[model samples]
Target: MHTLRLSDEHLIGLARWATDRMARVERPVLAERVLGVAGHRIQDPRARADVLTAAAEARLGLGHLPRHLTQAYAAELQCADEHHKAGHRKAAAASAAKALILAFHRVAHIDGLTSPLATDPAQFTGPLRRSRVLRALRAPRGRVTASAAPPADRPMRLLLVHSANDNFLPVVLDHYRNHPGVEVRVLDTAADPATAPLAKGLGRMIASGIGIRSAYAGQVEEALRPHLDWADVVFVDWCTAAAAFLTLVDPGTTRVVVRLHSFEVFSYWPHLVDFSRVDDLVFVSEHLRDLAVAALPRLREPDAPATHVLDNAVDLARSPLPKKPDARFTLGLVGLSQVAKDPRWALEVLRVLRRQDKRYRLRLIGDSMEPGVSPALDRYRTAFAAELAPLVASGAVHMTGHTDDIAAELTNVGVILSTSVRESWHLGLVEGAASGAVPVVRDWPFFADRPHGAHSLFPRDWVVSTPAEAAARILAVNESEESWLESGHEASEKAISTWGWGTVAPRFDSLLCARFAEIPAQRRVRTIAE
Candidate 1:
C-alpha cells in the first residue's frame, strides 16, 4: 500500500500525459493516476489546480470514474478557496469554474448510472463549496410579493420543477391535476435540450460565487420568466443544480419550494442552493432533515426557509394483495442498482434463514449494479457478484431486474427486507409492508448511531443490527402461517395508514394552500426585506 509521490513539475507533466492518453484512448486507469497525483502528491495550489482540472476535463470527455472526478472537484475547489483568501480573484474564479464544470460532468455521469438509492461518493462535499454559495447568496434577492399571493377563490397555479428525476412527482401531479383548486405544469430541465448550456453556465456562476448579470443569468431569466409569471408557486424536487439555478434568477413573485432527499445532502448540489430564496423546504423524513441541517447550518438560520418533514406519498390502495401460500418463505428486497442498497446483506440474511429452514429464499427486485459508474461501486459490485453467483446458481437468490409492477411482485413476498447502508426512507420496504409483507430493516449504517435514524424511523422490533438478527426476526414472524399473516396484516395497516397517498395528501394540501402562514412574523419581514 505504498503511496506514489511526485514533484510538482512531474505531477503537471504526468497530468498532461494522462489527459492526452485519455483523449486518444479512454482509459479510466490513466485518469486514476492523475487523480492520485492531484489529490495526494501535489503541494502548490497552482500545480494542484492544473492537475486536478486536467484530470477532470479528460475524464469528462471519456465519461466515467465519478470518484476520480469528485476527487479532482474537491481538490480544485480547495485551490480556488486558497487563491480567493489570498486575493487572487482571477485565479480563484478560474479554479472555481473548473471545479464547477467538473461537478456538472460528475453529476450527469453518476445520475445516468443509478436510481435514487445511490451511495455516497468517495469524498464528502464539505463546507468549502458552501462558503462560495453563501458569499454569492448574501446579497438580497427578489421574493414573492405580498400582492402576488393567489386569491382564495381562484385556482392556485402550481408548477413542478424537476431535473430529470420525477419518481415522486407523478402522484403529486395526478392529485393536483384532478383538483379543482389547482393548476399544475412541469418544467423538467434535463428533458429540455435548449436550456442545457444555460444550466451549466449558471452552475459555474454559483460555484464561483460571483457573476449576477452574466449572459447565462439573463438567459436563465428569459427561459424561466414565463414559468415564474404563470405559476403562483414552484415546487423544485431535489436540491440540485435546478434549485441553485432558480435561486440565481429573480422569480418575480413566485413562491419557491425545494425538497431534499438523502443523497443530495452528501453532494455539492445542496451547497449550491440558496435557502434564502426558498419559501419552503421539504424533507421526506426527520432523520434526513437532521442530517441536512447538520450538513447545511443555513437551514437552521433564523431567516432560512420554513422546514417540514413529510412522508413520501405511496399509493397503497392496490396493495395487501392476497399472498400465495409459499410466500411465507420468500423474502424480498427492492432496488439493487445502487451500492447503498447492499444486496449482499440481504443474501447473508437469506443464508442465515436457509440454514435454519431450507425453504427460505430471497428475491431482489430492481436493476443490477451498474458497471463502470465509479471505482468504489465497481469494487462493491465485483464483490457482490462473487457472493451472489453461487446463491443464484443454487436457486436460493433471485434477481428480478427492474419491474414496473412492484405491487404484483410483492404479492409473492412474505417478508420485506430493507438492507440499505442508508436511506431517507425505504420506499420499497414500505410498499412491501403495504402489500402484507412483514418488514425487517437493517440499522442503516450511515445514521444508525445518530439520535434519530433507522431505529427511530421504524419500530424497534422491525429493525436489526445484523443479518443474524434479521434472520431471527424473519423466522420468528414466520413460525406459523397464521401468525405470519396476522403480522403482515398489521404491517399492511400501518404502512397504508402512515404513508399511503390518501393519508399524505392532506399534508401536501396544507403545504400548498397554507400561504406562508407557518413562517415566523420576523422571518416574514426579513424575507420581504431581502
Candidate 2:
C-alpha cells in the first residue's frame, strides 16, 4: 500500500474534480467539502493562478457548472483580484477579473442572480467608481405615511420592532395580532435595510469622534416620522439596536416602550439609547430589570418611565403532547444553539442518567449560532462541539436542527432541560413544558443568587443547581412511566392555562389603552395631520 501527500496544485485539481463529480451526484455536502479544500489551496499564489487557469479551462470545456459552485468560484476569483489590487499587481488583477467575469456570467443565467453591476455615482472619486453588490439584497422603499384617523377606532396604532426570525416574535404577535383596541404592526427591525444599516453604521462609528446623535439620527427620524405619527405607541424589543434606532427617531406624541432582555444590558446599545424618548420599559424578569437599572444610570432618572416585569408570551394551545413509551427516560434540550443555552451541562446530566440506565439518551434541538458574531459565543460553541462530538458519534446524543414544529419534536422527550447561564424568559422551556415535557431548569447563573430567579418562576422541585441533582430528579420522575406522564401532564396544563397568549393578550391591550389615554386629544389630532 502507498500513501500520497498531494501538492497544493494537485489538491486544487483533486478538489475541482471532486466538486464536478459531487455536483453531478447532487451531493451538496461533498461539493461544499471540495470547495473548502479548493479555497484552502488558493491561499498560495502559485496554486491560485493554477486554480484560475483550471476554472477558465473548465468553463470552456464543461460549458456550465452548478449555480452554487460557479458562484463560489467567482467569489474566489474576486478575492484573488482584491489581493492583486492590494499589491498593485495589475496584470494578475486583470487576469483574476477576467476569470471572475466569465464565472459570473455562467451563473448569472440562473434564477436570482441577474443584476448588472453598476458604478455608484455617489461613491465616485478621481475618475473611478466602485462596483457595489447591487443585487436581490437591496430593498425597494415604498411611500409610507401616517394613518388619517388611528385606523378604525383602535385606542392606538402600535408598532412592535423585533428580529425577523426570532422564536419570540410569533408569541408576541399572537398576543396583540387581533386586539380590538390596538392596531399592532410587527416590524422586523433586523430586515429593514434603511434603518438597520444606519443603526449598524452608527454603532461602528460611535467609538470614533462622530457624535452618537448625528450618525443615523436624521435618517431614522425621517424614515420613522410617519410611522410614529400614525402609531400612538411603539414597543421595541431587546433594548439594543432596535431600541436605539427608535429613540433616535424621536417618537413625538407616540409613547415608546423598550424591553430589555438579558443579553442587551451587557451590550453597548443600552448606553446609546436616548432614555427620554421611552414612555415605559418592560423586562421579562425582575433580575434583568435590576441589572439594567444598576448598569445604566439613565434608567434611575426620576422622570424615567415606569419599568414593569412581564413574562414572555407563549402560544401553548399549539403545543400538544405526543405518544412515546420510552419518552420517560429521554432528556431533551429544546434549544442548544447558543452558549447561553449551555448544552454541555445538559450532556453532563445525560451522562449521569446513562450511568444509571443505558436507555437514557439526550436530544438537542436548534442550530448553532454563527460564531463570527461574538467572541464569548464562539468560545462556548467550540467547547460545546468538542464535548458533543464523542457523545454524538456514540449515538447517545441526537441533534435536530431548526424546526418549525417543536411541539412535534418534543413528543418523545419526557424531561425538558434548560441549562442556560441566562435568559429573559426560557420560552423553549415553557413551550417544552406545554408539550408535556417535565421542566428541569438549571437555575440560570446570571440570576441564580438574585432574589428573583428561576426559583421564583418555577416550582422548587423543578430547579436544580447541578447536573447530578438534575439527573437524580429525572430518574425519580421516570421510576414509573405513568407517574412521569402524569407529572408532565400537570406541568403542561399549568403552562398552557397561565402563560398562553389568551391570558397575555389582555395585558398587552391594557398597556396600550392606558398609554393612549394619557396622550392629549389635541396632540393626537396634530399627530394625525403630520
Candidate 3:
C-alpha cells in the first residue's frame, strides 16, 4: 500500500497556497455551498452575491472546471437576483440550473450547460415577448389593426359559491380581497333561507329514490344570471349542492371553475354536477383527482373541462404564538366534530401515553357535525362519543366544544394531532403546526397506500400508522420540555414557510390565469355535436 504523510505546518502552507490561488481566480464551489446555506435568504442580492463569490473561489481552486461552468454559476446568480426582485424567490429554478451545470461539467459536456436566460430571454421577460411575436405573425397582414387596447373597460367580476359556511370560505375570501381589477360576490347554497323549506321537502322526496325538481332550481338561475352577466369568472368550491345549483344556471359568457375537496368524491353531488357547463375543476391533491376521476366517469371524459391540482391555501401568519410552558404534555385535535376526524384514535394514543406517564392529555376542539342530519353520520358519532366519554370523564381528554379563535386555543397545545380516517388536506393539523404544535399525523387510511397521499403531502417523520406508533412518537417528542418546544418551533417554521398563504397564493393565481386563458374545447365540441 502506498502511504503519504504531511506535517501540520506543511498542510497549513498548502492550504494557504490553495486559498491564495483561489483568490486570484474565480471558482464556484464555495459560493454554491454558501448559497445553499443562505437558502431562501438568496432573495437578498447582496447575500446571494456573497454566496456566489465564495462558491466561485472554491471552484477556481479546483483549477480544471470549464469556463461555461463559471458562466452558468454567474447566470444563476443573475437569475436569482432578477427573480428575487420580481417577488418570485425562484429557489427551485435557480437550484435546477446550478444542478444542470454541474451535471454537464461532470460528463465533460460543457456546451450542454446553457443558461435559459441566454437561450430563451423571452421566458424570463415580463409579458412574454414570444407570445406577442407569435400573435403578430399569426395576424392577417395589411388589415389596419386597431390600437392594442382591451376591447371593453369593465371591472372583472367573480361569483364565489360554496355549499355551506365553513373555515375554507374566509381563507378563499382573504386571498382575493383587495386584488386589483376584480369584483367578487359570494353565494352560499346551503344558507339561502328562501329555499330551506323546499330543500327539506325535496330531501325527503330524494331519499325515496324519486327524481324531483328542487324548489330552489329557478332561484339558483335567478341568483346566478346577473352575477354571470357581470362576471368574468365564477368560482364554486366543493362539488356539492352549490355545484348542482351552478350547473343549473346558464353561465352565458362567464368562465366557471369548481373546486373539489377530498370528501366530495364519495358524495352524491359528483353525479349531479353538469360537466357541460363547468369550465374548470380544481383538486387539492393529485390523489384526490385520481379518486374523483375513478369514482365519477364524467370527469374522465375528454370533453370535461380542464382539471388542476391546487393545494389548500393556509394563512400561516396567524399560526405561531407564545407557547405555554406546560404545553409539552398537551396533545391537540382540531375539527373533532366529524367521524372522519377519528378523535378516538387520538384518545387511544393518549391512553398509551398516560400509561407511561399521567402528564399526557388530549384537547378536542370544534363542534361535532350534527348527528341528527344523517343516520349514517349519527352511527359513527355515537360510537365516537362513547369511546371519548370515558376519556373525557377521566380528565384525560378535554373538549373545548367549538371556538372561532383557533390560534388562541393552539397556544396551549404542544402537539397537534390528526387522527383522521380520510382527508382532502387536513387544514386543522397544518394550522396547529403553524401554531407551533408538533404535528402527529395519522396515515390517512383512505389514501394511505395511494401515491401522492398524506405520506407524500407531509414530512415522513411526522406521519404514523397506528395509535401505538403515534403514542410512541409523542412520548419521544415530549421526552423533555426543551426538545418538545424545539420540535414545535421547527414544525411551525416549516408550516409558515412552506404552506403559508404568502407562498401558496401565487400558485392559485397561476392556476386561475391558466384556467381563464383556456376556452373549454368541450363547449365548442358540444355546440357542434348539438
Candidate 4:
C-alpha cells in the first residue's frame, strides 16, 4: 500500500473538493491531511478559517480530528480578540462565545454554523446585566457580611446547588440532609424551568465579559437570592454556569463554597466566576488544583477564595464484594460515553493480554458513545466501532451498557482499567478497586508530564505508561487466583480507607461547620497554597 504524502498543493485541491462536497470515504483522510500540515502552513486568517472549517465539516460528516481543530480554535480566538479591540462589542462577544464553546466541544455549534451559546446581543448589552457587573465590582469589600450564624434554635441551614450532572452530590446530599447538625436543600439550576435559561444566560454574559444583569440574570437572582439569604453555607457543585451565576448575586452573609471538577478547567466557565465572593473552592485532586490555578489567574491572587484539595465522597461499603472465580481473566472499564475516557486504550490493553492468553476478555460497564454530541466524539466513535468489531464478535469483549448497580456488575470484573487521557479523580476506577478488583490506571496523558498526575494520584505501581506495561502488570497479578485475590484485597482496603464516604465526609463536615466549630480539620486535606 502506497501512502500518499499530501502536501500544500494536495491540501489546496482537497479544500476545493471539500467545498464541492467531497466523497464520504475521502472525508477522514482529508481531515488527517489538513491536520497533519496544510492547516498550519496556511498564513492568511480568512483562508485559514475557511480551510479549517472545511476540515471540520469533513470530520463531522464522517468523523479523525486533524490539527485543523487547534488551528481553527486559535483563529477564532484571534478574531474575537481583534474584534474586541476594534470596539465591535457584539461581534467580539459572538466570536468570543464561539471560541469559548469551541474550547470545550470541538464544534462551534451543531448544524447551524452558530454557537449554541450565542444569544440576543442586547441581552449582554442591556442595562440589567451591565449594571449588575458594575455594581458588584464597585461594591465595598465589607459589603458581604461575615458568615451568618444559624438561629440558636435551628440546625445550620445548608444549600447544595447543582446543574446537569449530580453524580457526586446524591451521596453528600443524603448525608447532610439526614445530619443532626445541618438542614439541607438542593436547588438544581438545570431542572428548574425558571432558572435553567438564566444559568445559561449568565455563562454567556461572563464569556463575553459584557452583561451580568440581563433579564436572565434578574430571573436567576429572583430564583436564587431567597435561598442565598437562607443558607449559612452554600455548596455549588461542578463550577459551571450555575457557579458563575452564583457570583452574580450578593451572598450577603452566606459562606459560598464551590467545587471544581475536571471539565471546568478546559472551559471558559471558571474564568467567569468571581472567586472573591466564594469562601472556599474545592478540587477533587491535587493535579486539578495545579491546572486550575494555571488556567485561571484569578485563582492565584491573594484575595482568591481559599482553595482545598479534598477527595471525592464515594460510597465504598457496597463495593467490597467477593469476585467470581472466572473474573480474574476479565478486564472492566466503566463510563465509556466520553471520548476523553479513551476506551480504545483499554482495547489495546486487552489485545496485548489476549496475545498471550486467549481467555482474557474485556467487559465494558457503561453506555457506548452516542452520536450527534460533537464531531470529535463522532469521529472517535467511528474509529472505536471499527476497532471494537472483531473482538466483540469473537466474544473476547462483553458490553454491559449503563448499569445502575456497578457493585453488582463488579462480581465479574477481575481488573478495572482507567484508560482516560484525563480525569480529576476517576470515580469508577476507585469504585472498582473498592469492589475487590485490581485497579490499572493508565498514566493519564493530559497530566502525565505535570508535577502531579495518575502516578501521584494513585499508588505508583497502579499507573502504567503503555498497554504492554498494563498487560504485564495484570498478568503478574493474575498469575494465580491467590495472587489476584490478594492484590484486589489490598486495593479494596486502600480505596475504602482513603476515599470512602465515611472517611472523606468528615472533611466536608468540618468545612460546613462554620457555626459549629467543634469539628476538627482532617490532616489529609490540603490548601491550594500547600
Best by TM-score: 1
List TM-score per model, in order: 0.82, 0.65, 0.64, 0.79
lDDT string for model 1 (233-273, tens) is: 89999888788777776676677878998778756576567
Can you list the residue pairs that collide in candidate 2? none
Candidate 1: list runs displaced more than 4 Å.
1-43, 48-75, 82-91, 97-134, 137-148, 193-197, 201-203, 207-209, 518-530
Model 3: worst 10 consecutive residues (lDDT sum): 140-149
Which residue runs does candidate 2 get wrong by more than 4 Å?
1-155, 163-166, 193-197, 203-217, 369-379, 515-530
Model 2 C-alpha lDDT per residue in residues 83-201, reported as the tens digit of each score:
44465343333434344344334222211111111111111111111111111001111112321334444456778886553556666675566655667776766787665565554
Candidate 2's displacement at residue 291, Å, is 1.3
lDDT of 4 at 440: 98
Please tell me which model should have the higher TM-score, number 1 or number 4. Answer: 1
Estimate every model's Cα lDDT from 0 to 1: 0.74, 0.62, 0.61, 0.73
Candidate 2 overall lDDT versus native:
0.62
| Cα shift from native, residue 467, model 4 (Å) | 1.1
Q: Cα RMSDs of all predictions?
A: 5.4, 14.7, 22.8, 8.2
lDDT of 4 by residue, 394-507 (tens): 999999998899999999999999998778999999999999999999998777878899999999999999999999999999998899999999999999999999899988
Error of 3 at 323 (Å): 0.8
